[model samples]
Structure formats: structure tokens, C-alpha cells
Target: MDTAYCTADGTPYYIANFAQLSESEIASKRRQLICVECRWPAYFKRAATSGQGACFGARPHAPTCSLGAPPSKKGPGSNEVQDILRNPMNHIRIDINYGAHDKVNGDPSDVDKANTRGGRFTGDGPRGPSPMNRRLRPLLKALIESEQFRNSNIIVELPRYTSLPANQLFVNFDAVDEGLANEFRGYWGLIFDTGMSADGSFWLNTGKYDDLSILITPEKYDDFKRKFNFQLDRELEGMHLLVLGKLRKAWSGKLIIDVDDVDRCALCDD
Candidate 1:
């Protein structure tokens, strides 16, 4: 694929013009890339060492998508819509079993977020064995690939938080605003840019709408990187990130989501 639609600038992007962009420009636009035809998530593939030129690609497009390659002579076409129907997402839930370190009030930095206003909680320590918690990838993938799922009234319930319709619960970064402040929502978007603060906390930011970002504290850095295979040096500008957290405005006026546990977040490629 050579062309894609950028939701950041609301324009079509051609790979041939990719080189015209500076490093910073690419970093900003790459995050908002999507398929021009079906609007599925899209990504930029940099020119490889093997001699391939830079190009655009996306998750499997619907069979009817004009950008998708033709079906092979040996088999029928791929139908994302049909596949979603065969195995629909019943509901969204992420349950993380806490360890001794995660006990409430165990560490000085650990604060009980409940019964308070504008207070943040960092998980005490390492998470215990993951129980049979439903993964968010399938649901996130469905939301990205299926318009029906995105607009559906499916339920998304996070433990300790109020359940809401999928349409209302999952908000893209582009739609974030002050009205949504201090509420727990499934905030998701592309990785426009990333940076490490002097405090050693890392930020995966969407460079629009008050610079919405997901914060990974220093305590959780090791676990977060190990869980997500994250590398700051890598070209991660266009990857997808979904975080289940309370949307809060920082003292600096930046919209932020503090990820207390690694399990509360998920990342994927287009």
C-alpha cells in the first residue's frame, strides 16, 4: 500500500511524499494514519535494509475494500465482517490479580484512588499471575476493523468502574476534551511521539487535543517495557495503544492517563 488517510491532518498521504516530511513531521502524521478506503488502522513501513522502499500497510482490509489485494485463485476472499460475526465480542473486561505489593496502602507512593478527587494510584508492585481475564486486543481489533462494533451498544466494564456502552466508553484521543476530565474511559489512539520525563516516567503521547498521553511511572517501567516489548529507539510512531484509565488534566493542563498496572494497557500494530 502506498497511500493512506491521516486523521491528524484529515488528508491523504502518499508514500512518495513521505520523504518530503522531516523526522518530526513524520512522527506526528504517522500516528494518525488510517486506510483511505475502509478506515482500518494503517502504518508506515520504512525503507528496509533489504532494499524495499517505504510504503503504507494496514491490518487485513475487508474483502470489499478497494485497497485490499485481490483474492487468490486457490481460495475465497477474506471477509473481516463475516469473521467478526462468527465470533463477536460479548463484553470488555480486564481483571488484574494484585499481589502482596499491590495491597492498598502498602507503599508510600501507592494511594487508594477511590473516595478521592484528582488523586492517582500507582500499583504497589509486580502483578500476580494473570487469571483468566479477557484480553482487550480482540475487542480493540474489532473496534478498529468493524464500524458496526465501534457504533454498537456493546458493554465495556472495567472492574471498580461503571459499565458503559462501547460507543460511549471507548473514546479516541482526537475526541478527548475537558468535559471528559476526571472520568474513567477507554482512551485509545496512535503513538504520535514518546518521551521520558526527568522523573523517569515515560509518556506515549498523541500530539493533538491537549496532548493526550498515557503515563508509565518509573516503578512500572520494567514491567511495562517487558510486557509491551517497548523500545524508545524503535520507530513506534504509528502503533496503536489502548489504555483503560481515568482521564485527568494535569497541573500543566495536559490530558493524562496514569497506567497503574501493565495489564490495564494493550498495544498493537496496524
Candidate 2:
């Protein structure tokens, strides 16, 4: 769409063309882009070398967004997935430290509390703020403020395991260790394939490396399929996906996450 709402002032603006936006303008506007319909987070895409025109689209359209587009009539070209996979950033790394907030043996000094307020963990041990949090802070801030994700549980740092079970939130796994599968079951990776089940559920695959896949529950399949414009079976391949849900070990020993809510998932641009 040519028009988009800005998060800065909650005002609509007409983007005549991407070419008209300078680098600084693009960077500034892109961060605040929002969908005019549901006021959810949206992204601005510049015109491609292939002559495709510029447009604004939702990162993940709200469930009730009236302006959300239906699945495209034409499927993505073969090279589309390859192009996204070529970018290393599209393959996101996930860290799920269950005990990130454990109190250190040393007492918290007044300086520590003053420096880090609002219940921010002051522990400086190995369980303290992770490298992933430092890297993803800016993006997480943007996502948390975005209309679509603001209400969802935005978990950057791991919450207390006592309050929320690790299985109920997220878990990370190493390829070599299958023993901890039950404890740490969450899967994160670059999606490379997707298919529809005979019963109409949507399944996403991250290829054979980690043997990870996501099963979008049948009730949520339509909304997710439309939101991401996944008409064809493989439409969502190459997108970055982070999903939290029930983990099931398939007969083939692949890890499949059964997702019942759209809010527990985040799909990022390539």
C-alpha cells in the first residue's frame, strides 16, 4: 500500500515512492511504520531491481485486521527462497536460559539497585543478561511497542522458572544432546519448507539439520496463512520463525512444536 501510519505520532502518511525516501528518511520511517487498518507493525519495502514497485505491508497483520491481504494468486518464484536463505541474519539464534534471574550469592549493593531499577536483574554471574539480549534489545524494544505484539508476552530475558515453567515458555536444544529434549523443547531456525496436512493444519520445516518443525493448529492455520500470504505449500520457506508451544517427538525423532496461538510465534523479515 502507498499509505502507512507512523508510530511516532500515530498519523497516516503517504509514501509516494521508495525512491523518494533518502537513506535517513527510510531508516527513520521504517522503524515507525504501522498498518492503517489495525495499527499493527508494518514494514516498508523499496522497489526491487526486478521492477517490482515499492509497498508497505504488515510484519504480522493483526487477527482482526480488515485490510490484511488474502493469499496471492501467484506463488513465489524458486529463487525467492534462495535469496532469503543466502542472508545469514535471516537464520536467527535463540538462547533460552531458564535460570537467568537467579540471585547471586553476594548481596545487591545500593549502587546496583540504583543503576538497574524496575526489577531488572542485577546479577552479573553466568546467568545474568545474555549476549543474545544485548544484541536483540533494540529490535525487541521495537517489537514490544508495536501494536500487534505489545499485548503478547514479549520475552527477551528469561522469566523466573518458579513462576513460569520452562516448558510453558521457551527452550533451546543442542544437536548433539537428545537427552534434554523433554526439558528444553523449543525450536528456532530459518524456515525452509512448509506443507499442509490432510486435516488442514499448516506445518513448517527448518530442513533436516535440527529436525525442527512447527505445526500451526488447524484453528489458527487460516489466519496465519493469510497474514503471511502463504498460499502455496512452500510460501513461508526462508522466513525466520520463533515459536513456543507443546513439543512432540515424532516417530522419526524430529521435533515438532504444536502451536495453538498466533501470539506465541514471531516471523521476521529476511
Clashing pairs in 1: none
Q: In each prediction, how many residue pairs overlap at the backbone (N, C-alpha, C within less than 3 A)?
A: 0, 0
Compute the lDDT of residue 102 as modeled in candidate 1: 40
Specify the poorest-scoring 10-residue window by lDDT in model 2. Answer: 90-99
Judge candidate 1 at residue 8 and give its lDDT.
Answer: 83
The most accurate candidate by TM-score is: 1
- Give a tens-digit lDDT track for model 1, residues 1-270: 889888988889889897479988787677677888898767676765447677787654665888875544221112333333343344444433322124343433322222121111223533333221334655566565656766777666665676787789888777888789988888876665577889998888774432788888999887777776655524555567788888888889888888976767777764
Question: Please, what is the whole-model Cα lDDT of each candidate in the order they appear?
Answer: 0.65, 0.48
Give the TM-score (vs. native) of candidate 2.
0.38
- Score every model by TM-score: 0.66, 0.38
Q: Using lDDT, give the best candidate's number.
A: 1
